[model samples]
Target: MKAALVNRKMGLFLALAGILALAVAWWVEHVLHIMPCELCLVERWPWRILILIGVVDILLPGAAGGPVLWLAVPVLLTSIGLAACHVGVEWQWWPSPLPGCHAPHISGHTMAERLASMPLLPSKPCDAPTYLIPDLPISMSMMGGLYAAGILVAFCVWKYRVAHTARRIFY
Candidate 1:
C-alpha cells in the first residue's frame, strides 16, 4: 500500500523550497555582502530550474503529472556536482574548471588600456571560500551541497510512489 499525494501540493512545496534556497543565497550576497565565486553562482542554476518547474507545475494543472517531477532528479544531481566542484576548489584538492579562475583576462597591450577595459569590480577568486557563520569550518559550497542534498532527499521521499505510477502509466 502507498500513500497518495496531490501532485500540485508536492509541486508547490518544491517550488517554495527552490525559492527559499535562492532567497538564502541572495540574502547572503546582498544583505550580508558576501561575494560569490563563479562556481557558487553556477550552483544556483539548478535551483533556478527547479523553481521554474515548480511554478509551471503549480500554474498548469496538466504539468504536474507530466515531465516536471522527473526533472528534479537531474537538476538535483547537477546542483550536487556544482557544489562538489566548489568544495574541491575551496579545499585546494583541485583547480577550478573555469578559465577566469586562473586570473582576470587582460588583453590590452598597455596598463592604461587594461585599466580602461576593466570593470568597476573584479570577481571574487574561486580558490577562496566564505563561511556564513563565524569560526565555522564549513564553507558556503559545502552548505550548498547540504541544502541540495536535503531538498533531494525530501523530493525523493515525497514522490517515490507517484513516480513509479507515472512510469507505469507512461511506459
Candidate 2:
C-alpha cells in the first residue's frame, strides 16, 4: 500500500482505539461505579484529544500530513506524562493538588448529608492515594503504567510510519 494510505489506515485504527478506551472509561465510571480520581479524569482528556486528532486525520488525510504529525507528538507525550503522574501519586512519591475535583470531603454537612453527597463528589480524590481493581492487589494508579505503555506503542508506530514515508519520498 502507498505510504499515505498506510498512514490513513493507522490513523483510523488509532481513532477507533481511542473511542474504545473512552467507552471503557465510561463503563467503569457509570456502570461499574468505579469512581475515577482527579488524575484519572485528567488522563482521559489526552485520549479524547488523540481521538479527535485521529478522526480528523482519517477524514482529511492531506490536512494530517507533516504538520499534523508534529501536533500528535505532543498529545502522545502529554498522555505519557499524565500516566506517569498518576503512577507517582499512587506510589505516594508526590502529593496531588487539592480542589473541588480532588477534595476528599466537604465541610458543613451532617452525617446523612455527607453520605448523600458522597456520590456527588468526584468518587476518588487525588490525595486519597488508592485505586481498587477487581481481583487485583495493585491500585489503579499502577494501571497508569499500562496506559503509558500503550501510549508509547502508539507514538512509536506513528513516528515509524511518518519517518519511513518521509525517507522513502526523499530517496
What C-alpha lDDT values do all the predictions have? 0.81, 0.67
User: For model 1, what is the alpha-carbon lDDT of residue 119?
Assistant: 59
lDDT of 2 by residue, 46-141 (tens): 778768777776766764542454555677678767777766666677877535445555454688776765655445656454445656756555
Q: Which 10-residue span in candidate 2 carries the lowest summed lDDT? A: 98-107
Candidate 1, 1-171: lDDT as tens digits: 122236677678778888998999999999999887778788889989998877776666553544676688898888888999989988999999987566776668998998887756788889899888889999888988888899899888767767687699889
| Model 1 segments more than 4 A misplaced | 1-5, 62-66, 107-109, 161-171
Point to the candidate with the largest lDDT: 1
lDDT of 1: 0.81
Evaluate residue 87 in candidate 2 and report its C-alpha lDDT on the 0 to 100 scale.
Answer: 67
Predicted structure 2, TM vs. truth? 0.73
What's the lDDT for residue 136 in model 2? 74
